[model samples]
Target chain A: MPTLIKHDKIMEDDWAIVEVEAPADGIRRIVPLEAWLPESGDGLLLQGECEPDARYCVAPLIAINFLVFSDGRGLSLAVLLRSRFDFTGELRAVGDVHPDLLYYLNRCGFDSYLMPDERSAQTALSTLAPYTDYYQASVLEPNPAHRRTRRFA
Target chain B: MYRYDSFDQKFVDERVVHYRAQTERYLAGELPEDEFLQLRLRNGLYIQRLAPMLRVAVPYGILDSRQLRTLAHIARHYDRGYGHLSTRQNVQFNWPELAEVPDILQDLAEVQMHAIQTSGSCIRNITTDQFAGVSEDESVDPRPYCELIRQWSTSHPEFDWLPRKFKIAVTGASVDRAAVDVHDIGLVVFRTDSDEIQFDVKVGGGLGRTPVIGQMIRRGLPVRHLLTYLEAILRVYNRYGRRDNKYKARIKILVRAMTADGFRDKVDAEWAHLEGSPSTLTDEDLARMQAHFQPYPYDSQPASIDTLGSQRLEECAFDAWVRHNVAPHKQPGYAIVTLSTKLTGVPPGDVSDVQMDLVADWADRYGFGEIRISHEQNFVLPDVRFEQLFELWQQATSAQLGANNVGLLSDMICCPGGDYCSLANAKSIPLAEAIQRKFDSYDYQHDLGPLDLNISGCMNACGHHHVGHIGILGVDKKGAEFYQVSLGGHAGNGASLGQIIGPSFSRKDVPDTIETILQVYLDLRHEDEPFLLCFRRVGMDPFKERVYANPD
Candidate 1:
């Protein structure tokens, strides 16, 4: 079994990802965004294109699935969910989560991602820590680059 | 030339690490090909027909001697011994492994350079006039503003993933050598009577499948509002620009759909929110940017050098080289020498490693150790003493870099066509070569005078074919390649797109057709009237009739 990298830690992911929403087995089952009930302490599942505006209200945890899609709408959606909607809950990126998208996903909002295997997951995690500084203000940093830089005298 | 501070240096370092991770993920099979393509392209790496082509940015076409040597080192080590100077003022290496691109970016970062936004759908390298600081006609130098825009646009988070690629060009010179009118956003920088610098902001000008002359939306915008005003235009474009079809995605299509006036209204509405933002340029910021471009310490030189005069009187080649290749400088007795890369048989902008080293050495010897790359695909040494002209000309000729054709017919802007680029419809280099060989005679080419002949392999218009005095476009007809001819195009002051003369011609017939068009121009033009001015005065009807007269 592949080790899951979540919140900078390697651990066994127990949450079962599912498509439909309904009477769930408490927080163990991650259901579709539509099935996410308010304050029920349910985990919500999101398609790459699913809007995240209402996720902040109900879901205790949200997992955005990277659809077998070519473009990167999922990445942007994750970024917007955190940066715009201020979704502070445990965010997970699943489905066809390419190893390369992990660093960007981490920057965007995702605290965890489904990797193919343990070795690949560990390698992907290593890529994230190399950049000691970044240009843009993101989910990692709230202040933009202009505010971060030293202004000319 | 601009110097990098700690902030600039650190940003590049971080960017290299970021791109390196992206490449590592792809190599490790963690990132899929499609996802990695976007990341790699933004770093100026493209998978071409033969091999991967990596484009390294030279911001506003400016590079110092150290940067040039670093480029030479990269070209020598990472790529083949030569590099092609692109029309966008970036250097393209046709052969390189994708795996080594991050390493290439790392090397570039050490020199305060990165390939960020050189490709992909975002703001590109902010281009400016090649003679920006030293031009005699410029009232205020545009290089500072160019630097300001470049810094603001790099790693721009919001606009990184735009509907289509965006280009911005600035020019402070009276003559628009930068071709500002054909850019996505054209900033015409100038000073008011009170000596305050301002910009006449023009938007939605681009050359591609659809060619356009950018409409001036805002006139005399104060320099203080530079970043905020640009932010306004980009926000509007990002939100409203079409994304449905790639062909119709450029800002020009958006501006045309909503008339220029309507687009201006939208931008005005957007600007209202950003006008007083913290991003606005402060006096200190302006001074800091300007400090990097302080005037060179020029030694007063005689108006005419005795040796140069004697050489000119004796050797016809030296006289022709000076007349065509050299440009007048703002500083007295100094001249800007253009080292033409458009030698016969060679591609328009291809320069070798030894040549680059030679030019870098010459820059240090004759002037400031800096170089500028023109969009016309030539190198410029901005400061050279009058006395050094004859000697420089002799050395340059020996290197085959002394084609005394700056604005002449043979000095064409040709793109790397089907041979290297997958997007090309035909080969542009061969067509340029055929035309150059036909008019190789210096006397004939000089007599033709000031012809902006441009050829593009495809409708992407990388060569800016639409703005050429005589534009030639390679069109894909069925499964075969054909050439399309256009007339009366010009990129400067009165910028206009060339009108198609007739039906597309076979590749073999292109040179003859151009000859016929020029023949008609020679017959019709008044004394000392240039080819473009004459063509504009009479319209394409005259040339059109003659070229198509013997058509089957």
Candidate 2:
């Protein structure tokens, strides 16, 4: 199972997220974000390294933490993770994931969006096809750039 | 006229398809509001106070009869049966639906027109003298150079996302009718001692909260290096212009922060880097663009225009119009006639559908079917025979397009402020109406002499109030609307920013304030002095003292 971290709160050893509390005894370590590489530990949760230099290594089975979706730093982070960093892990967007921003979040390569509940999560999926075409380059589609170049050429 | 070739036609056709797809995507919920806002604005669609306002670009203010008729048809079918001509020489429709904009653009593209780059942080329309090619005083036809600039600047990758919108204007004549000094970049084409056409470049001049008259940076630059030099300026602005604050984002602020000399050094450094870039203009390219704007076939006349001077003397109204509205044309028997839109009860630059159609017909009936929109918010018949003046005036008067207030106070330049714009602090159109209503008499306006009264709702100076002889600015004082009066501003061969008179006045007191200011000019003038010279002869102290001395 993919691990998830609430970026705003610190977890004690007994806090288990699935059981609504901390686990009694598991991996009892608080890894500072700078040293916590995706390859260093299995199912490790990380947050707050928005301008990561080496984000590509974490491409497999990593649950990134988004403190707030409206902050817009997360969108850039997600784009970097997908396009430049090539992170194809289970990209779950958590914390303040408004239903309105899900379309952009999905385009930026977020797979499983963590909203308030299941109904709102369905609402997020509905916003994905709001427009037909775009003029600028985006991560989800590489066709717009080609089409514009051919036309202007 | 620059006829659209296959390349130009295909480009606009493809753009229409592109915009249609974006509209579909927006309606399908794939594009978010904020993201779509940027996209639509780039296509000249603005979500104004009540509805979407579409600003249609009139490239360098030149249009033929078919284009004008197309605009009239659009106004009739899509808008409120009318359109407003803007000070930037574009036509704005106030009520285009958000979903119908793509179709609207398609219709415009059929006539070699598009709203692209009319809004957003890109190079807005490139303007030139309304009498560019036909003016007797012109050193060269500036339209070809303007067309070259348009091609170079349109959809430019590096410059599209500037800190703010940029404007460039060029004038080939010595008279400076294009108001080049108030633009972001201004070029004046003149022949050097060797008879080669050269450009004098001016940069970082604009009208806004900080109104500035541009300073000349390069003198007698050869015409070949125009695009290269422009690219240099844009690169410097894009890389270092302030983006942290929108108000301080224009190149003027950046130029001001690092004095003009320092800015010139930086631009030179940037030009050094772009010395051999592909964006540089080639002689072949210049020739190709020049071929598009070749002079029309003219039939030489047997008689000079002065032969009809005696007939105008018999009709006083036509005589006044001939003196004020007619400009010297390069052709012997022809004149550039400015048909003022500033009638007594109508808003400045507001032309109904019928009026638009009539003007289109007049263009065909008078000279070549070509028309131009002046920066002063008037229409120009670039070629009209001097003998046809009375006949054209008769038709224009019947259509309510023959107002003889071309340079008078009633012909004010106003912004669509509080009524339409979301950023306006006060209403501008109504204030303009109040001023026009007070000065409706033709005799009174004629006696007042040539005066440019400009109004802006806010300090952004969309109305270009800073360059008016009598400038009125709407100010918000503690949530209440007020008017600030200024005098001595001029825009022409000689340009200066107006100085604020004193404390602001209530909206009800504005018309009286203007009357008092005009009275001061009338009382203190020499026989030959215009309003500007009179204001300069006796400084603002006398006008300011007279205006605010009696508040009641």
Candidate 3:
């Protein structure tokens, strides 16, 4: 219904979201990791639950729900997946994705965001660009300032 | 005393800009009220009853004179020439405009300060003993560990939102001035027999409506596991602490519902995953932070008892001041001076612009230019030379900060209650002043000896009424305000919450009620028994029966 942000740009949505119990329609579709089959790995999108522990089973597209603007569970999940699992998949953040939260979400290793329109996505891009450095460690920078600098290293 | 490296400087500066943008969006009405509330709170801006009150983080209650002068300048320009030092050792400005808060934060950033995580449901300030580095009884300085926790928790990715506000207090001193029993997660850094720095971790202790002493969850946790252990604890709390009701949202409630043993199991399970991550601090990191707080070089000098005795002979007031206000410093020939902000007629912890500037000057002239804000709401010059005590006392007197009531009954811990706080049940300043007026005699207070009389306008316990020897809490009866008295609570190595004496009394009768309680202690106490000891020796029955018996 709307364009998805793939690799930081609004891209055409060819894949459709399908339930785990859906029949194999031979079309590319995003499904939960629990129901993913080896035969469907060629042209299929996959999602994981919001919980960090759910990432033991890998997926191409691990979707985490922001749920609310203030809820930080999704961001923490993304960070844990990236830093702990070294996950190299498209971490898609959907649901209640406020424009202002884009910076923190991007810092926590979310590569794609689901926004309602291209204008909102473009507007939210500016939020991710500022504050090039931070004091603490995140997915964007695995090493904290102490380790990077010789003062404490 | 922790100086900002380039990374810290950049982080704080970026936050100043980020908060400014948030303010701009808020002013444009693009962000809704509910969303802006959390965002503003993260920057320590509060929409109080009268105006916007900003609580700036004073990390571990440490500040240098330059920062103090910056605060004075902010007060003079932005506020009504005064600021309130809160129980958590942060400073609060009650009358700053919403739009100007960003500018205030910008100014604070220039001084190596930011209000990050001072409010919100995230981690608040990491507090400790005001006499952190210099206390004689402290086995080790807790500031370095506090600094470590401050950095780890600052803008942490996972814990930016929590079920409720979290607080952490650390102390290495056997005397628990940090009030470890009344915090979310309290740390006591202890050295093992082999000289390894380890921590005794306490969790789920808090002091709102349902106050519970913290349970010691982990003992002898090595220093390397500090961050991992804390991360484990916070992860457990963030994932499971109650968010359904604001009243039952603190980790204490969660720990209670899960049972402390069950909660420890959950934390241990979480720790198994997070243990020994990159967050595990190295000894080099600890040493780097420890180097910031080395004792200042002191010139060798012979004892100046004769000169001090001559000054003491000049006036009895100065002698009394030295007796109460001055404390023994860890370093020889030096003393720790507690400049009393508890002068009768002024609200406890409220310092004016001129007083701030003067105290900053004294910090520069007499000590190492560093100042400490005690949880008891007084300023501490941590390294004053004993020879200069007289001049320091004289200069402090000119600023109306010369009260000799360090541990006395008149030195009460109070909150900015109904006058400024929207959540307060009644006015606390007037009540504090009434009590101070009654107990104005220094000799009487001295005879009382090391008494803690704390007041809170509501059950929030911001005044720390739960831990005071004679705790006064304001209650609401129908439409009228009333005060309740509790006894035997002391926040120390032997920490215990005070039990309510009896039925609540009228606001006007609080001072008299306290007097009656003190009389009971005075009559029952042996020659030198403190109020707390006397109360403990003869339990709450004697005082409770006497107070309820004469329902005045």
Candidate 4:
């Protein structure tokens, strides 16, 4: 079983991640976006290049697939999915995730991460929220530092 | 200069702590080398030819006296006693231990500075005219917008890991002093007839393997929509930019592949969706940022012009320094003074710790306690009193900062080539020094008039060789070093790329080749026309003929 970090804490994950061609018959399995029908209540898995559309907005969980940690297209996709499409469910990051990338992944609105192992999951938790404040607006904070904090001058 | 408030200060402090942790993890072997490379690059540390080179962001080229002292302290205490000023208005330390970079970042943060996003595949330090607020030709000061962009781009979540490095430049002056056309995103800020601030946005212009001028994607965009529009552009680039080949990954390649109109359509589509989001600048937001850049309290009384005129008449060196280095300021009694770093023997932008301290002291005594670094590798005192020009010039001459060559040929922009950069194909500083030695006479340089001589180690064009009036590019021929020369390039108003003269030259023959080209210009030029104008009027044929003709 893979380690999971949900809401910034290590936890045992029960949701199943199905591949694009894999059969996902149950509601607990997060099927690929192509496989998940609108009527089916199964969660959707989105690739980095997937079009962020409103059709998949009703999914209970959307796990963004990253082929490599350095490919940042999925980060922007998550931002658009949350801020523009108003996807208010569990946003998870899966595949090729590393502890070094957790801080940026969290900032871009990943609420859950499927880590490689237990030790890496702990490292990921430590790196998250390294900075209490940030300058720009994102999915986590709609208001930037200038709008949220009281400036001296 | 924009002062960092409590909110901004705290953000930078937290960043230093975060970077420190990252460095520790890498050292402990918990982080992989490939992953650590990206993390360290985001903090502006690059593993170079000989050692690690640390680049500190100057933030639109503006620095205060305190920040200058801090940089000097870093130079004295860290890996070296000297630092090199980059063409992007930032400073680079040639040698810094990788383990000690966090300490350097901590020192910089104490002065409200950081190296965040300086040299990663992300947004770089925003640059503008060195004489931003004081220049007489500009209607609006570009610093406030530059600050806004700087904050927005710092540690930006989605755009931090782009396919290639991105650079943005802003200019508000009638003349393009910031070299906006060569940046990833070039913004020309101006005011409408009704006193409304607006921006003309250009996209996908850069200098690297492929040096293409940026295209104007939008015109007369209101100031409030700046961030949203920028976000739209970045998002489009992040999603669609090439990831296969590093050389073809810049946004310019994408823009070229899609064509300007097609790329503009894509950007417009993206912008239309997010034009009025939470990122839109509010009236209060605009006012607050504008307040930070209000005009300095200049002396209202007119400077003593007769005294200055008498001093100039008395000393020919003072007159020449004033004629070449001083620029007109918006305020009547003030002047913008450029401290030339290109003193004959020294590498173009290299400055010692002592020189940094001296410049800081001069900034406090002669004008406001503020300094600026220009893209042409020179320091600028933004608010010098016209009456005190003679005194400052005399002091600067002894200090080697007063070279009486601001835009002249010897004040060339040369990059740290094979000496410091691992990516360089050939050495550049030696060629620059040889040329400077040949053209040592002030009378000859003054008679020759304004010329932009740029040199780069390789096709990366860090020295902006493509836009130089006389561009020299270092090339590698069968593992041996060779020099390629280009002519007729200019970076002002209507910027144009230079054309290669003929063939490559040996290192020993570069200076004489340049002399031959200049001789052609001198022989053909009418009266007092500048080198660029003369070259433009008479095409590259005459110069090419003169140089390549049998030199028996």
Candidate 5:
């Protein structure tokens, strides 16, 4: 079974994201972007937008829902977020993260990738570090220009 | 040669380790054969009929003296002291042990090289004209764009698991030396009236079970939009390309099914969505990449060849070689020389360790220490001084590099067929050898004039038999090897697939069949009209009748 990480665990802060079965009366807390960020919330959780608009409320963490493992909409979204918006905030990738996709995801600039398990997450880290030099720059390493001189080194 | 930076080094080192583990897992039987094949193929390791063949990426065929030396060292130390230059402008070692491939890859990585993406359904080596940066007729050096495409395609996520292998060829020259017309995606870099560089994109062209000439989908696509456009095409192919039958999975089949117009619409729609996306190349990025491919330091010398005429006349062999092998360079006093490897008794494209080292030394001594491997399976010294041509020819001759049959009938492009390749239907190397033996005389070859005799073991067309003036395809008749002859194929500006002549001939009769076809060509020529033109004029009827008239 694929593991799921709530948006709260991804952030360095102590915030938890729980699914609301029902909306209660009085609680001063952050809500899902769909509920709170449409008009006023300063952040957004882009679910399936591969090419999201740069003019968002706040730094978006594109979520990858487990519709299909082969459906690579999240990758396009991550690349779009990095190349278009120049979004510097934590571009965390979440859900059904295949081990093979980790290298590309990291290159596309997903600092934190949410794999199905801790083992897979660890594997992702190792996989991302497999190659030391790349001819081209990705979101994570945006300066392939500097890497050319160091290609042999 | 673009030197790798620290990040590039780190990436390759990391990749080595990653592949090491993968290799280990495979050896440990942790990974299944089918799954591991994809992973191994991406690293350019292929399990052949006799042993594993490891293909090393040459990166648009651009290699420095140092890289060539490294290849020589690998050839001497690793395999059978010989390497085969492949059609994709890469080098292949035919007999590397499966267990030793990691070590071989590590050796390659030491020289800032890797066999990454040389095969598999993922993006293969991004190729361009061997004369990319130095050609006189070039509008722009296509290497930077080729490099850019290389980066974007390397380890790409969504497109890695494609329906079949994808190839992209780029050309900036008016003449398509890179054979762009017969690739999955052919990009021709051109400048508009406004002096803005743009790409004329062609799609769906390929060779194999089906031979296709790519259809142009977009014209005047600005340079900055290269990656975005490529992404659009890949996305379209990835999503809709066939997966049920491997044989029917190439983009050519998909393009045929959708029709060119329909496929273009699909790609355009995808591009529309990706217009302002991150994948969209920026001017800054293009500029930076362009900086890496700036023209080499060239000496200020007279461009005219008035002084070299007397020296060339002194040596008839040298004159013949110069006429056939030498190409005009963009820079003055320099010429692009193709060192043919199609010597009799040697497999086409096979270069020995000694030859590789000698070529490297020559590159450093005579030219700009850089070399290129042409898709027609020949090594090119892109910047040789015209005055030094005779001297270079002498050294090349001593080293057996001076075949003097560059574009001649004997200069065959052949693939390692049934002898090495598991996929081959018949032995192609022997056929090539037979043809080479028959046309051993340089005088005879020169008289025949600029004929391409290409042979492939199978329909894969790795030998590029479809584009040859005299094409020979190896076919299996029950358990016997048979050769099918074709004529009028050209891979230049006027590109066309070869037409099959008649029935397949037995191994013993193949050479005689080719001889008959040539005799017919010699008999039916109009003055100095080349083999292609004569074949076109006379049509295949004369040649076909002659070839099949005395069939064994």
Candidate 6:
């Protein structure tokens, strides 16, 4: 089982990732987006160049798989899911996830990061709070610095 | 200049702390090299061929004397006692220890400056005209908008990790001194007939291997919609921009692949969702930013001064410097002075620590204690008195900053090619030196009349060679350094890319080839016609014929 950082705490991932979709048998199975049915109530795994759809928000968890860490398309996908589609379920970042990209992943509304190891997850947790203020409106904070600060007024 | 408030200052300070931890982690071998490269790049640290180069943001070229002094201090202590002024109006220190960059950034933060977003695949520094507020032919000051864009783009959640690097340039003048058309995003600020400020938004222009002029996506967009509209464009790009091949990843390629009309429609569709969001600027927000850039207090002196006339009549060198390096100011007796960094033997934009300190002192003594770094890689003292021109000129010439070649052929914008950059195909400085030495005559160069000769080491085009009146690109031919020359590229008004001449030349032959091209221009030019006008009139056929006519 992979150790993941969720909600700023490290824990063993409980959900099982299955290649084939199954009719929800009351088991926590994460299936591919194409195979998962909305009625099954199973978590969805989004990979490759998939665009954000509000239809995917029905899943209990939506894990975005970054094929390559440097490919930033997943970050935008997460932001659109949270900011535009208002996805309230658990958002997890899996595959190519590392400590270096965790801060951005968290800011873009990823509530869970599936780490390669427990050590990497610990490093990601340690360096997560380097900033308290940000200039742009993020999924973490809908109001930007200008909207909240009185200096511009 | 917009002073950093509590929030802004805190943000930069936090960046220093964060970057310090990243550097420590990288040194400790916990972070992978590839991942650390991206992290370091976003913090404005680049692993160059020789040493790590640190780029500090100038915030649209505006710098106070105190900031300049801190830059000098950084150069003296952390670097090799000099810094290079990049074409984007930022200062880059060529040599800094990888571990010591945090200390350097800390020093920069003390003076309300930071290296954030100066590099990497993020929204880089926002740049504007060096003489934004003080120039005579200005419609509005672009600094406030530049500051606004700078803040909005800093650590932007979704857009920071883009497909490729992005650049934004703003210009408020009727004359496009900021080279907005060649940037990733260009904003032309103007006032409506009813005196309401608006922006003409241009998108997808860049100068790399594929140089495309920006297309105007929206005209007369209200000032309040600037941030939201930019967010819309960036969101569209972040989602759709190509990421498979790094070479084909710039927004220019995406815009070209999607077609300009198609891309604009997509942006409009995205913008509809973010138009009135909390990120939208209010009237108070605009006013607050504007208050920081109000006109400087000026002494009511007569428009014309007899001493300036007498000084011009007395010293021919001072007369030449004033004609070339000094520009008309909005205030009557004031002038905008460009301190030329393109001395004959020195690298074009490299300034030593002693020179930096001296220029900072001059900035305080000559103008308001403010300085501007021109994208042409020169220092501009924004508010010099006309009467004090002669005294300033004498001191400046002694310091090697008065090169009287502001727009002349010798004022070439050459990048630190193979000499410093690992990405460069050839050593550009030697070629620049050879050409400068070949065209050493001031009278001959002045006769050429306002030519932009830009050189780049590689296809990355950091030197913006694509838009030069005479563009020289260093190419690797069969593992040896060779050169390609192009003609008639312009960056202002009606911007156009240069057309490549017939073939490549050896490094030794580049200077002679430039001279032959100039000979063609001189023979074909009408009286008082500049190089670009002459080249545009005669076309590239004649110049191509003469240069290749006597092929050795």
Give the number of the best model, judged by DockQ.
4
Whole-structure CA lDDT of model 1: 0.83
* TM-scores, all models, native as reference: 0.88, 0.80, 0.94, 0.98, 0.85, 0.98
Deviation in Å, model 6, residue A148 alpha carbon: 0.8
Q: What is the TM-score of chain A in candidate 6?
A: 0.88
The DockQ scores of all candidates, in the order shown, are 0.18, 0.05, 0.38, 0.76, 0.23, 0.62
Per-residue lDDT of model 4, residues A49-133, tens digit only = 7789998888888999888888899999999898889999899999988887887888898899999788889898888777778
Q: Model 3's lDDT to the true fold?
A: 0.84
Per-residue C-alpha lDDT of model 2 across residues B230-291, encoded as one tens digit per residue: 87787677656776687888888988898889999988986775565454556765676677
Residue B307, model 4: lDDT of 61
Better of 1 and 3 by DockQ: 3
Residue runs of model 5 more than 4 Å from their true location after superposition: A1-101, A104-153, B302-304, B550-552
The C-alpha RMSD of each candidate to the native structure, in angstroms, is 3.9, 7.9, 2.9, 1.7, 5.7, 1.8
Which portion of correct inter-chain contacts appears in model 6? 0.65
lDDT tens readout by residue for model 6, A18-59 = 863343555588889778999898899997368889999999
- Summing lDDT over every window of 10 consecutive residues in candidate 4 chain B, give the lowest-scoring window: B302-311
The 10-residue segment of model 5 chain B with minimum total lDDT is: B1-10
Assess chain B of each prediction and give its TM-score: 0.98, 0.97, 0.98, 0.99, 0.98, 0.99
Candidate 6 per-residue lDDT over residues B1-552, each given as its tens digit: 788888888888999899999999889997779889999999899999999988999999999999999999999999889999999999999999999999988999999999998999999999999999999999989999999999889888778889899999999998999999999899999999999999999988989989999999899999999999999899888889988788898898988998989999999998998989888889988888899998888888545755588889989899999999999999988999999999989988999999999999999999889999999999999999988788889999999998999988888898999999999999999999999999989999989989999999999998889999999999999999999999989998899999999789999999999999999999999999999999989899999899989656
DockQ of 2: 0.05
* Predicted structure with the largest lDDT when compared to the true one: 4
- List where candidate 6 sits over 4 angstroms from the true fold: A20-27
How far out, in Å, is residue A4 in model 4?
A: 1.1
Residue-level lDDT tens digits of model 5 in B232-252? 898778767776687898899
